[model samples]
Target: MSNSNPHRFSLESFRRKLASVDALPQLCVLGVIAGVITGCLMTLFRMLLKLGAMFFMPDNDPEAFEQLTPMLRSALPLLAVTLIGGWLALHSGGSRHQIGIAHVIERLTYQQGRFPIRNWISQWWIGLVSVLGGLSAGREGPAIHLGAAASSGLGTALKLPHNSLRVLVACGTAAGISASFNTPLAGVIFAMEVVMMEYTTVGFIPVILASFMGSVISQSVFGFDPPFQKAGVEMDSFIHLPWIAASALLIGLLAGGFVRLARSASRLDILPFALRLGLVGVAVGLTAFWYPEVQGMGYDSMRLTLEGNVAVDVLMAIAIGKLILTAGAVACRVPVSIIGPILVAGGAAGALCGMVGNMLLPGVHTDPALYALIGMAAMMAAVLQAPMAALMALLELTHNPQLMLPSMLAVVVACLTARQLCGCDGFFISVTRYGMHPLQQPLMQALSRISVPAVMERNLTRTRRRLSYEQASALLDANPEWIIIERSSDDKPALAMNAAHLARWLLEHTADDVLIDAEGMFDLLEIPGERLELAPIHLQATLSEAYQCLNENPVDALYVVHGRRPDKPRISGIITRSAIERYYRYEDQSTTKNR
Candidate 1:
C-alpha cells in the first residue's frame, strides 16, 4: 500500500529528486532548512548559556565570572569539571566524545558526512558546562558542531544520497557561523575555506543562502547588533605600515605558540579522562583567580580593549593568559571552541602594540582602536589560515572601509609569519592533523558532481543463476546492456555478465558446445571476460563511490542495488568502471579535441 501522508510522500519525492546530477535546486532548499534549524538551535544555546549564568552571576551577566567570590570562582569550575569529567568517564559512548569542528572535518573526510546523534547530544552539555563553569571556552565550536550534526542527521534520517548529506553539512556549517557572529558573508567563506575546503558556484549558492537565512533568524531573536561595537577609527598615515607589520609579527607568533601548546596538550591522550579534565579545571581555576578576563569568551574584556579602557600591563597579561589557558583546555579535550579566545588574545596583543607606539614615538599619531581591530583580524587569519574570511569578518563587524588596507597588510603578514616562520598551518590543523586530509582533486571533484542513478545503465535483464543457451541468446538479442543473474544468497553476486560479451561468445562457439546443459553454459561463462565480479553499491551511490569501489577492489564493474540490508538486496542496474572513466575523462577528450 502507498503511504497516504502528504508530508512523507513529499519528502520521499524530494529524496528521489536529490539523486540527479542537477541536485543544486534541491540542495538549496535543504540549505534553507538547515539554516533555520541551526539558527534556532544556536539561539537556544545562547539563551541556555544566559540561563546558566543567571544562576550564579550578578544581574544575569554571562561574562560576570569575575564578580564571584574568590572561593566560589575557584570552586565552581572545579565542580563543573568534576561533573563533566565524571559523566564522560562513565558514559564515554565509544568515540562519541569526538565532537567539534575537527570531528566534523574527520567525519566528512572518512565517514561521508554522517555525524552520530550521540556526539550531538554530548556537544550540548559539554559546551554548556565549559562556559558555565568559567572555563576559557568559545560557543562557536559547539554551535558549529551541533548545527552540522543536526543537518547531517536530517539527511541520514531521510536516507538521502551521500552527496546531498555532504552539502547539507556544509550548509549547516555556514549557518552556524552566521548565526553565531551575524556575519553572513564570512560564514559562507568560512564554510568553503575551512569545512568544504573546495568550492564551486553550484556548491557556494546553497551555502550563501544558508548563511543569509541563518543571519535573518538570529537577528529576529537577538537584535541586529554586530558582536563587537566600537567607535570609528582609521589608519592616519603610511608611517603606520611598519608598526602594523610589527604587530602582525607579534600576533602571528602568539597564534603559532598557541597552536604548539594545544598540540602538546592533545598528545597527553594516554591520561585518564577525569585526570586530564581535572587538571584543565585546576589550571583554569588558578588562572581565573589571577586573571578573570580569561574566563568565558572574554568578549567583555575585548570590548574594553577596543575602548582603550584596559591598562597596557593588564592587556598584556590577558593576552598571554588566554593563549596558554585556552590551548591547555582544548588539549585536555574540553568540549569548547577556541575562535573567540583567539580573537580576544589577538585584540589584546594589538592594544599592547598601540600603547607602546604611543610611548616610544610620541610624534607619530596612533589609534589603539585601529590596532586592536587589526590585531583581531590578523590573529584570526593566522590561526585559521583563512585570510579572506577573517578580512570579511573585520569589514562586517566594523563596517569601516578605511580599515581595509591596513587590515589586509596585517592579515597577510600574520599569515605568512605563522605559516613560514613559526612553521604551523593553523590551530585546527595543528591539533587535528590526522583528520586533515587533502581536498578532493579536480578529477575526483568532477566525479562527485553526479550520482550513480544518472550514470548507471538501467537497461538490464535479471535472470536465474543458470540460464539456458536459448534464454541467453534471446536476452542478448533484446540488447540489454547487462544481465544480472539472481543470487540465492544476498552476500555474493550470482553473476553480472556483459550482454555484448555473451553475444560475441555465442558467435565464436557452436551452439552444441555451449548449450550442452544449463550448468555447462554457466561453467563456460565463468572464463575470464565472459563476466565480471560484482561489487554491490547503493542505487544512490555517486560516480565517486563507483570509482572508489573499482579502485579499491579487483572488480571491474559495480552492481547498483536497492536495499541497504544484506538480507533484502535487489539489483537495480549496473555501472562499469570504464563507464565512470568515460563520464569524467570525456571532458579531457573534449578539451584535447578542441586543442
Candidate 2:
C-alpha cells in the first residue's frame, strides 16, 4: 500500500498537493510524464497511419488520394464506412461512439477528465480507417483524443486525485497537438485557449513542458520536418491590408456557415446510425468521383494552393466543395476529423481571393501563398473561437514574424464576423451544447481546486452510540469540537453532535442533584443535544464533490474516510455544507482584494 502520511514524500502526498491550487511543481512533474506517454502514443499512431496508407495509397504517401483511380476513390469511402459502422455496431451502447476533440472536452468538463478505455480503443481504428479510406478526415483530432486518453489512463492507473487528472488531460491535449504538428508553442496555446478554456501560471508551465517534450519526441522520430513547408513569404505592401481584411470577413462568414451546418446536421438523430454513415459515404464518394482533391485530408491540395500553382477556378471549386462535403460528414457524425479539411478549404478560398485581387488591381502585387497562410489562421480562429492559438499556429508554421500583422487583422476580423455578425458559437462548443459548461460559475471552479482534507474539520472524536456518563465525561476532557456517535449496525448511518452540547448536558445533570448510577449508560441518540446525520466521502474528493454529496444525500455533513471499501472505512475528518460556502466566500474576498 502507498504511504498515506501527508508529511512523507510519497504518491499520496503528491496527490494531496495536487488537490491544492499552488501545486505547480507537482503538476509540472506530471506534465512531463504525460508528455512522454503522449509522444510515444502519437508516434505509434502516426506510424500506424503511415503503414495503413502504404498498404493502399500509392508510394506510401498518405496524401496521395487524388492519385487513386476514380473507381477506388468512390469505393474506398464506402468500404471504410461499412467497416467503421460494423466496428461501432459491435459495441452498440452508451458513449463508446464518442470520439475526437469534442469527446475529450466533454469528459474534462463533466466526468472529471476520466476517459473511457472503450472510446479510446475505438478512436484508434476508426481514425486510421477514416484517413486511409479517403474520408476527408484529419489525423490530428484523433491524435489529440489518443494522447489525452493515454494520460488519463495513466492517472487512473496510479489512482491520482481528480484535480491532477484534469491537469494530466490538459497536458496530453497539448502533447498531442505538439507531436502531431511539430508546433510546441501552438500546442500549449491550443491547450489553454481551446481545451482547458482557462489560463494560469500553474497551468502554463506544465502544458509548456509537456508540449516541448512532445515536440522533442516527435522530432527525434520524424527528423524535425514541419508538416507545412516554410513559406518564406511576406506582405509586400501596406496597401493590401484592406483586401486582407475583406477576405477575412468572407472567410469568417464561411466558417460560421460551416459550424451552423454541422451543428444542425448533428440533430439528425432520427436517422439510423448505419443509414447516416452510408449517406456520408455516398456523398463523399460522389464528391471524390468528380473532384478527387476533396478526398483524404487534402493537405497536398493545400500545399499546391500555398505554392500558387492551382488555377483560380479550381481553387474556388475546391474551397466550396471541400467546405460543403466536410460540413456534411460532420453533420452525419461520421467521426471524420474537420481541422485539416478546414485548413485546406480556407487556404483554397484565400488563394482564390488573392487571384481575384491580382486580376482587379495589377499594381498591388498580391501573393496567393501569403493569403493562403492568412486564411488558414483566420478560418481556424473563427471556427474554434481561439484567436490566440490560431495566431500562434500561423507564426510557428510559417516561421515568419512578418505574417503576424496581417494574420492578426484577419483573425480578429474573422472571429468578429463569425461570433457577432453570424451568431455562431465555436464548432466544438456547438457540438457539446448539451454538456455542462466548464465556466458556468466562478465558485464551482474555485471549489473544484480544493480537496476535502484542506477544509475538513478534524477536531472530532468517534465513539459508540451509547456511552457511560463517566465515559462521556472522560471523552470531554480531550476538548474535541464534535462527537461522532458510531452506528450499531452497518446499515444505520453514523451521527455527529457538537461536543459542547454533550458537555452542557453533563453539567446540567450533575448540578441538578439528580440521582444517577455511576455505570448508567447514556444513549447519545436519546440525549437533548441535536444529532446530525453523516455520510461517508472519500479523502481524495474535492470540495465540489463534497458539495455534490451534500446535495444528493439527506445527511447534514460528510465524514471524510481514507479508503474505498464501505465495510472498513477509516474515518479521518468531517465537512459541512456551511464550511464549503465559507471557503468560497473567503476565496471570493481574497480574489477581490488581490485585484
Candidate 3:
C-alpha cells in the first residue's frame, strides 16, 4: 500500500532458506546409517583388539600363551602393541578426532555446536587400535563421541533447529552405548543423565528413536543376543537393602579412590603419553599372566565368575588389578571409555565381595551372584557418579527384578559417598573445573558459578554525577531504563545513586545522616534515602543486570570502574532502565544479524 519494496521480506526469507538446508527424512536416513556405521566400527574395534591379544601370545592355544617364551609373549605384546598403537595414533583418523564428551559439552554451550569431523574419526582410530593392542581401556568413549559427532554432522547437513540438533547428538551418544553394550534402556538414561541432563518430552523423542534404531542396527549386525546381559531372579527380598547399602558404600569409596588416583596419575608430566600407555600395557599383560580371565574387557571373566569357579582371594586380587589397570589405561588418554572398564571392574569387585561375604557369613547368607550384582551397581554408580545411569545399567545387563532394590540402595550410598569424599561428581568434572557451564551442574556447582565473574550483564552505558538538575533530567530522559550513581577513584566501590531514589530525595530535599554509599563514595552530601546509591559490588556488565539491585533497594545511577584505577569505582556512567532496554534491543538485533 505505501509503495514499500518487497525486499524487506527478503531477509527473513534468506534466513529460512539457510535453515532449510537439510531435510527431516534425509536426516533420519543418515542418522540410521551413521548408527550402523558406528556399530560396525565398534564391533571391528572389539574384534581387532582381541586379535591383537591373540596374536601377541604367538599361539592360538589358550594354554600355550604362557608356555611361549616370556620374551616372545609378554614383552612382545607390550612392545608390538604400543609401537603400532603409537604409529596409528600419530596419524589417527585426524588431529581433531581426539575430541571427547567434554569437548562436545563445550562446543554445545559456546560455539554453534559444530563438532569437527576430524575429531570423531581420530577418536575411532585411537580408541579402536588402542583397545585392540591390549591397552587397559574401554571402547564406549569413542563410541559415544563418534555417534554424537555423526549426529552433529547430519544436523549440519540438514540445517535442523539448534535444539533438535542437540537432541540428535544426545541420541547418537545413547545409541553408541546401547549398540556397544546392548543396554537399550541404559543407553536412554545415559543420554538423559550424562549428555542432555534433562529428561524432557522434547529430548526423549529423538533419543528414543535414535537409540532404538541403533539397537536394531546393532542386533542385525552383532546378533539378537545381549552382549554381556544375563537374566537373574526376582530378588523379591527386601532384607538385602541394608547389606547392599553397606557394600555400596565400601565400593563407592574404592571406586572414588581409583578415580582420584587415575586423574592424578594421568596428570604426571614426567611420563610421556606413549611410554605411560606402554607401561600400562605391560601392567595389563602381567595381570593377564595371572588372571588371564581379566584380559579383553573382562566380560569373559564375569562369565567365569557366574559359573562359580574363581576363588575368593583370587577374585579380590583380580578386582584390585582391574581397577589399577583401568586407572593406568585411562591415565595415558589413549582413547577409551571409563564406563565399560568401570562396569567390568565393578563386576570383578562385586564377585570378590560376594565370595568374601559368603565366606564370612557361612550359613544363611547373601548369594555370591546377589552380592556380585549389588557390587556392580554400587561401583558403577559411585565411579560414574550417576545413580540413575548405574541403576539402569544394572537393570538392562541383568534383567533381574531381585537386584533392583539392592541396586537402588547401593547406588544411593555410593553416589553420596563418592560426592563427599571426592569433590567432583563424575563424567563432566574436568569440564566443570575449566569453567564452561553445563546443563547438570551438581552440588558444589554453585561454588563454581555463583560469582560475579560467572553471571553478569555484558553491555553498559555511562553517566556523570556532577550535572545540574536539568542536565540530569536530560540524561534521565536519555536513559529511561538505567539507573545512575557515583564511583570512587581508588580502592573504593562503584556507587550508583538510583534515579527514583534521587527524585524522591529531591522531594524530601533535606540532608541528614541518611547518606548511603553507592560505590565506595559516601553520598552523605545532602541526598535523601530516595536518592540512595545503586550499582553492583565488584561486578561486571550493563546497567540492565544491576536493575534488580536498584528495584530491590530503591536507588539510581551507578558508579563504575574509573579509567586509571580499574578496581576503584568512579562516577563514569549513569543509566535509566529505558535507555538500557533500547540498547539491549539494539544489541539483540545486532547479535541476530551476526548469527
Query: Which candidate tops lDDT?
Result: 2
Task: Give the alpha carbon lDDT tens digit for every residue of 179-233 in model 1.
Answer: 9889899889888888777877778998888889988999999878765666568
How do all the candidates rank in terms of lDDT, highest first? 2, 1, 3
1-595, model 2: which lDDT tens digit per residue?
9767667888878877777777889899999999999999899998998898878788998879778899998999999999898888887552137899998988877777899888899999989999988888888788789988899888888877777777788899999999988889999998877887877677789989999899899999987755556556889789999999999999999999988888766477778878888988998899888788888888788877777677766687678888887888788878888888888888898888888889989977898888898999999999999899999988777778898999999999999999999988777874333343554346567877677877888888989977677788888888998898888888888998999998888878862353444656667777687788999988777788888889999999999887745656788889888899999999899878988
Tens-place lDDT per residue, model 3, 176-276, is 88887888778888887776666654456556667777777777766765434555543545665665676777788888887886677436646756676
lDDT of each: 0.81, 0.84, 0.59
TM-scores, all candidates, are 0.91, 0.92, 0.65
Clashing pairs in 2: none
Between the candidate structures 2 and 3, which one is better when assessed by TM-score? 2
lDDT comparison, 1 vs 3, better candidate = 1
Candidate 2 vs 3: which has more lDDT? 2
